[model samples]
Each structure stands twice: as C-alpha cells, then as structure tokens.
Target: MGRTVDQEVHAAFVEFRAKEDDKVRCVVYFCLSVQCIYCQQIRAKNTSRQKQHLLECPGLRGHPNAPQPSQPAQAAPNGIGPPNGYPGTPNGPTATPSGPSGPGTIPAPNGTLMTNGVNPHATPLQAPLQALQNRAAMATPVQATGPPSAPPSAASRPTPKPKSKNSTSSLPAPPLDDVHAAFVEFRAKEEDKCLSVQCIYCQQVRAKNTSRQRQHLLECPTYLSVMKDSIPANNLLHTFPEGDVARSLQIPAPTLELDFRMSIKMNPKVNVGAGIWGQREWVSFIGGQWAGRWGKGIVLPGGQDTQLVTKDSATNLSASFMLQTVDDPPAFIVVRTDGWLTGAKDVLEKVIDSNMADGVNPGSYKYRVNLSMETGDERYTFLNTLMWIGSGCRRGHEVIFDSFRVN
Candidate 1:
C-alpha cells in the first residue's frame, strides 16, 4: 500500500506488522493488505474479491480510523520503495514518491508540500516533483461519487416485437361448411340458370362463386363472430317469368303469316261538334270486303268511326264494325279497331286539297292500328287466343289493311 491502506483490513496491522513467513526468514515484509482477516473468513483469493468485500463492508466505509490518502506518510501500509527502510528493490533502481517533499509525503492543494508544519517556498526541484505527482494522480482510476444508476426506464428501453402478419388473434377461422350450406340453400330456392348467392351474415345477394361467398363469411363484420351457426333464411324471392324465358330461349326466330286483309269503303265526312277534348268528326262505313287463307268476307254497313282531332294535332279514331264471309253458311265477325293517324302538314294538306279521293304520298303518313275480334264461329276461334298487329293506309276513297298474327 503506497499511500492508502486496504480498507477491508485493520489499519494498524497493515502499517506496523510483517508477514509471518517473511519474519521467519529474517526477510522484512509488511503485512499483506490483500490477505486480510475478512478475506480469510470468506476465503477470497484475489484482489478483485478483496475490493468487492471492501465495497460491501459498512464498517470499513464509515469507520473514523479508516486510512486517508491526504495523510500519505501515516497511511502508507507498505513502504514506497522496498522492504525494511531500503530505498530500492533488489532488481530495480532507487525509487521515490513524486510529492513535493519526497517519499512518504503528500502534496498540498497548490502543488507545494509543508515541512515541519510550515509552508515552503517554491523551488525548481519541488516544481518538477509536483508535476510528476500531478501526472501520476491523473493516471489513477477515479472512484464513483454517488449511488449506482437506476435501471433503464421504459421509454429508453427498446420496444416489444410486433405480431406476425399471419397471426389469427383478431379474426376467427372461417366456417366452410356453413358457407357451403348457405350456397346450397340459395341455389335450391332460385329457379334461373344464372344463379345468385346470398351472404349468410348480411343476407346480401352476390354472384354465384365460392371465393366471394367465402370472403363474405370470413370478413363480413355481421357474420364474423357467428360463422359457425346456420344463418336464418331471408325473405328475398326472385324468379324469371316463364313466358319471357321461353321466348328468349328460342333459337330460330318464328315467322308470322298474314292472317287476313280488309278493304273498307267510307261515307262522306260527318262533322261532329267540337268540344273541350278536341274537334270531333265521324265517317260511316257504308260496306267493305275482306279475304285471306280464310274465305273472303263483306264488311257490314252499320260500322262507323268516331274520330278526334286532338289538341296535340294528332288524329285518334275508334271504330266498331262487323264482317260477313260469303260461305255456304256465312259467319259474322265483330271487329273493333283503335288507331292513330300522323303526317306532315304539307302532305296532309296536299291530300286534303285532293279531296280524300287520292291518298297522301305513301311514306309521308302512317296509320297504326290495334284490332280485337269476337265471333261465335268455330273456324275463326283461333283469332281470339292470338295477338294481332296491323298497318293500313288510304288509297283513293278506301282504306286497305294487312294484319298478321304474332307467333
């Protein structure tokens, strides 16, 4: 111990005594501070173990008699140079302490040492010694001045790891069987070839495919929690109309045949009084002729047309009449026609200027009519069950109509 005694051992033993082995050999040696009574009790075999015990020993830390580096000569347990008052070791040159006054002395704060309890004047020799002491002190290790630092705080510590992308903690596993059952139920209820499916959780209709259905079951918020249970049936019902589907499914378009043709003669125009709806007019059917694959017929005389010149400048006509075929036993057919007439004013004026004898230009005007017929005759009963459409035009003083049955 050069300046300070080992803190784990008795200071008096370290300063004054020698090792038992060294005394037996007549070789003088200071007591070994590293081999202390406390170290012996714990069997500490090294300097590090001795220092560790010193740090934990309250008696050494708080003792009033503990060695102080400030009193260098008094605190030196082993002499600074060699054993038993020698100034040098057996294998080394003479050694001396670097303090201002020489070996076994401590320097004061201002790099000067006191001799005989009085301050000494600065001299060249003392100045160099003080510089050497300063360098040696700087090279020494510094002791901790405060308590050990607390454990690192949470904010300063590294963050915990994140969960994996494939983790299933937040989402439940999909219920495949329930989803399949829902699809089956939907298909069974629908009657169309292009099927649609309903979401089991929200009852929303979707395209008939497995991927979309499974996605709905797994990710839909309403059904995610209860995927294992059967979803209640919804009230949605959809069916394609049988007639429309049958019509659409036809491969080759069906052709229509001419059902019949009619030629009617009209009486002179009769002026019906104008009213709020429009100007009214009438034309009486004096007689007519009709023929087709069915036998030819005569249009009866009592038929008449009630016409309206509507405010929109269009002509609307309603006509009810009868026809009697020239068969062995003639059959009488009652006909009702509802129609509209439209034309360019100049063309209609030209036709009117021609006095209804010769018709307007063929493409300049159009007459569209819908017809309904009633008859007790067995031969023409098929007309009652079919749909019919007709187109007609005026030529001279008569109107000719060609009607076809929609197949």
Candidate 2:
C-alpha cells in the first residue's frame, strides 16, 4: 500500500534518545541539534517547536496533505495590540490562552510564551511590546515600492497638433437697383474700369459701391431736406428764411455738359503798363473758328482782349468778339469772356512767352474763362438765356478752349 503524505513526511526524520538525554531527538541530524528534513534549518530537540516548524517550513508547505495554519487571531481592532490586551504581565491582568499553556498564558508566532514565561525577568518584555504598540499607533502606512516606471518615452507620448487658420472670402456686391443705377456711372480708366456715382441732390461724387451709395443717401443734406418737407409733420417746427423760401437749405448743384470749342487766332500783345490796379495789356484777335452745339461759325476779326497783369504776373483777361454762323445769310452773335490765366510766376512767364510756350504743358498753369453769348436771331434764342464756362490752353500764336454749358 502507498503511504499517506503525512506518514511520508514523518518518516523522513528518525527519532532517537541520547544516553543522558531526557528528550527525544532526530537521528537524521544530531541527538542534541535536530535539523528539519523539509527546510534543513537547525532547531532544538523540542517536540512542540519541531511540530510548529513543520507547519511554517516553506518545503513542507508544498505537500498536498500539509496542515493548514490557524488564522492569526483577527488582528486587534485597528491592529494596535495583540488580542485581548497585553498578554498577562506578572502583575498585569491576564487573558485565556488558546494553547495548552497555564491560565493567562499566550503562545507567540516565534514559539515564545508572550506571558508567564519560565524566566523570572520576563517582565522587561512588556516595555518593548508597549513601544511596538505606540509605534504602530503613530506609524504611517507604507506604499508599495518597485522599479519606478520609466518616464513615458518620447515616442510613446502623443504629439500635439497645430491649429488651422480660418480663411474668409469676401462676398460679392449686391445687384444695382434702378433708383441707385441712375446715380452710378461706369467709367473707363487707363488700366482698369471702375464705377462712379454723383449724388444729384448734394453734388458730392464718390466711388460707386452699393453699400456706400446707400449710406450717402441717408446723410445727403439736400435729399434729407426735400424728404422732410415731402412728409407731413405733426409738431411745430422752426424754419430758416432761406430754407422756407425754397423748401431746401441748399440748392441742388447744377450739372454741366460739353457745349462748344473755339480756336482764336492772336496778334502780338500790346503792353499798357502801370494801370490803376496793375500793369495792363491788350491782345487783339485776328481770326478764328468756333464750332458748337448751336452752330459752326467763323469768328469775325478785330476782336480785343484787355488783360490786367497782377503784381504776381497773373493775367486777368476780358475779351470781346463776334461770331458769324454759316447760313445763306449768316447771322451775327456777340461773344464776351472774362477770366484769369494764373500760375506760378515762372510757369506763367513761360506760358505767356510765345517763343517758349508752344510745348509747355497746359497743366502747368490755368486758363479759365466764363462766357456769355448774345444773338438777336430768333433761330438761336436760347443763347441769350444760357451761360458757359471754358478751359483753354495756349499754343505759339493761338488759344484753344473747350466750353461747357451750365444746365
């Protein structure tokens, strides 16, 4: 028959009694020093000690039939001390022993009597045990220690992503409406095309854009004045004498259209120096042509231009001339112009000098004139009522001007 696990473990060590010994000892080691068959640790030849050693030995603990250890008395509440207070001191209160010891005796894990030991000096053990209790009361819990986890490696960390920029596109302009379209005009430039609008009510010109044009209407003085009158008001309102006379504080500015152009032939200037106002001169017209919306004509000769040359060399011109229209019997028209030819002293000297004036840029000086026409012929009755303004440039021996009619 096969031996049980307990019997096999018991047979591994042999028991013997030495000649002068009172206790039995294992022959597997020595009569006085017994060595554990499982763990090979040397122990004294005490039966109870050997038995407890067998229970705790790591080698014997592997046996299938090895005895299971008793659960340690559930730790004292909060684990401050052993169960039932201090195992009885010599004169201290005692507790019931769970082992085969005398009353008030306790067995400790190391096979020592925690109380009532045979040693009469056992009372000193109380101080260390009491110190242990005090240390446990103040002790901090231990955290588990091991190899510190390596800091997350660079490759293992997540990479931060960059934020994208928002790109917004401009919206297209609104379609032009009929009311506003009348104000906007398409104009061509040298490099590109653009739109322009003139507020008919205020005469202020601006680049034509739908939003800006709408804002202009909201703030135009003339438009606002006319709008206020067209709407009825319930409250009493103060009125200005000028505004009451015309329902508007500011009159709508007039518009001008191209009307005519004239080329006047000139004779040499006759200097009449040191007049009451300034140095004076006279320049007479020999012959020229005038073409206009009214009719094409030849300027009758012997017209005179009286000039007042100011201290700054600015010339003021007053001219009188006659025009003959082309017809079976030509009708006669009288022409008179008054204006200034003004610029920097050097520029005006260059402009007036016939020798150096031929190619001088006209933009270097200004030759502006206001003109009036008188005609007795019924065919051109409108000439007496209308007025004209013109800008002119000087050539070697002649002056050319383009005139616009004020409407």
Candidate 3:
C-alpha cells in the first residue's frame, strides 16, 4: 500500500496526479503514468497493456523475475506510448533517468519524471525494441475513422445451385427419331431456335427437346391412359376376340423346359394297303421306361400307333400309351400324341423299313410330336394341366425321344 510495485503487474507505475477537480482519470490502478523501469520507456497507462509490454519488452524479457505475459484486453498492447506521445512529453524519445531522482524533479526536456529512480542500463534494450515496434506500426496502417467491413448481403452473394428433385435428371435423352414419332414438331415462329411439339395423344404443346418430349410422354395423363387401353402388337392377348375379357389380360409368353426322356419299344408294323386317304399301317407299343424332373416311371405295354404314309413318304402318326410312376402307391398317367415324320422320299422309305431304319441318321429327318398327359392321382395332377412336345428318332424297333414341358 506504500507505493510498492505490484508483483502481478510486474511494472513500475507512478501515482496519478489528480486534476484541479480532484477527479481520477485512470479507471484501473488509479495511475496515469507507467515508466517501465527495465526498458526505461513510457508505456500506455493501461493495466493489461502494461503487463503485455513487460513480457514483450526486450529488457524485462532477460530479467529472471520478469512476469510472463497474460491474455491482453481488446485495446492495443502498450509496447510504446501512443504515436503523438503522452502528456508532459514531446513527440520523440524520452529523457531516460540515469539514477534515483527527487520526487517531482523532471529528468529531461521531453521525458516524464518518475517519483522514483530509473535504472541506467534500461536505455540499452529500449532503443532497439522501440525502433522495431515503430517500424511494425508504420508498415500496417490501421484505419481509425471507419467501422469494420460488413459481410455480403443476401442479394449480393451468389446463390447455391438447387439439388435435383429426382434422379431422372441423369437419364440420357431419348433419340430425335423417337421424339418425332411420339410428338408432332412445328415452329411457333420462323426465327425461333426451339421448335414447338404437340403430343399426338394429349395434344399438349411444348418446346421440342428429345429428352423432355420423352419424359412428357411418361408423365402425360392422356398418353398414359391411351397406353393402358392399347395392346402391343406382339401381345398374345390380341389373338382373343375384341370384346372378350381375355383381351384385357396381361399374359406371359409360353416357355418350354425339358421334362424327360423315354425309349419306346414297338412291335413290327401291320401294313394296311392304301385307303381313301393314304397308305395306312399299324404298330403296337411294347414295354419302355421314362425318367424326368418329377418322377421315374415305366411305359405300360399295349399302346398302339396308327400311321398313314403319304405318297411323298411323309408319315403321320397317332399314338396312345400309359405311364406308371414308381411311388409307393404308384400313379398311372395316360399319354397321347400326334405328330409327323417327314424327310426325303428315300429317307422315309428306309425309316419305315425296320431293317434299314437302324442305319439312318436321326438328324437327316425330323420326327416331332406334341403330347398331352392325364392322371387321376392328386399328387401328380399338375401334369394334367401341362403340355409336352417331343423330338424323336426311329431306330429300327425302338423310338428314343426327349419331351419338353410347355411352361
């Protein structure tokens, strides 16, 4: 309390001389002058700035007991006094005190006299630090007359692009030919770069762009409605009568998957001389075995094939047989088929002759048959609704064939 330097402040501060009104001007420390005893330079009489100056001061920095700098306030650091100099001092370097001086005794023409002594060595560090500080202050000219630059206004700033509403933006545009086929193009004005197009279905008019036109067709109410009511040319529904309920159905095309293979053993043909239609012959189906995706079975004997041979040697065949599944309670299925065996006249002659048919190539002639199956067993009843087609080769007394189920 008796005019001692503050340990926290770590600076030499002199008491403020009150005005004639006896009012204190400095809010903090109640002091108006601070002469750094180490650097012997007058600093701005601010508590925080003075502390900052001591830490940055060249003379104080080397002192063992020098205070470390603390976080400073918004005001500038008190490295040196303001540009114009402090009160009682002119616009130049201060008259540094050489030793202890009596209170109120001015040391030089331009220096503030402290109520205490100034160390003689303080001048050596102050000159170099002050010159460096001054140069930095001159290099960066701070504006004191105006407020800081404000941020850009909403209207002045660039607007960010909007995200796409749907992924359709990435779709490649439809071709020009496709666009013209769907929409009728016409020019609104002779000089217009964009031609106008009218949808043939909805008659809606819009700018002619292949992508936009195609997208319009996809979303157009009238066009979608028309498409719903129309049937594609390749659709099997077109085969049904116009007003039939089946015509409105969405049916898939029939596909065939191989079901089984079978070798049918047959007895010798019984020739029936030429009838009103053609040369007729009868052949009886002997025993045979069959296997497929559903089950394995044997072809029951006693089935017959009645054939009519035309003059050109194309043979028409009608056959019927029975199949027995190998289940615990064996299921019996009825199999019936009708097909043709046609080839060169000589080829057919050899095919119809058991002796020569063994030597003929199956590929050299076509023997195809369409078959239908019927069963009373509930376990195998699904076969009753399906149809099969087979391609066969006649080898003397046996016919081997692969049957495909029509899916």
> Candidate 1's residue-wise lDDT over 1-407, tens digit each?
22234432232211111223332211111112232332223221345444455555554455543334323233234635333222332333323343456544554445545553222432222333334444444454433121133222323533323323353323344467766876433321212223445454565554466655665555555664353222222112643343332222213345667888999988876878788888898888989899887678799998998988765556787999998989779888888889887686656545433275264666777776878888889987866766567788776657788887667
Computed on alpha carbons, the lDDT of every model, listed in order, comes to 0.53, 0.62, 0.64
Q: Could you say which candidate leads in lDDT?
A: 3
Count: clashes, candidate 1: 0
Runs of candidate 3 with Cα error greater than 4 angstroms are: 1-251
Candidate ranking under lDDT, highest first, comes to 3, 2, 1
Candidate 3 lDDT, 2-38, residue by residue in tens: 1112334532443222223333233321123445655
349-374 in candidate 2: lDDT tens per residue?
88889988887899989999999989
**TM per prediction:** 0.38, 0.42, 0.43
Q: Provide the global lDDT of candidate 2 against the true structure.
A: 0.62
Give candidate 2 misplaced runs (Cα > 4 Å): 1-247
Best by TM-score: 3
Q: What local lDDT does model 2 show for residue 193?
A: 29
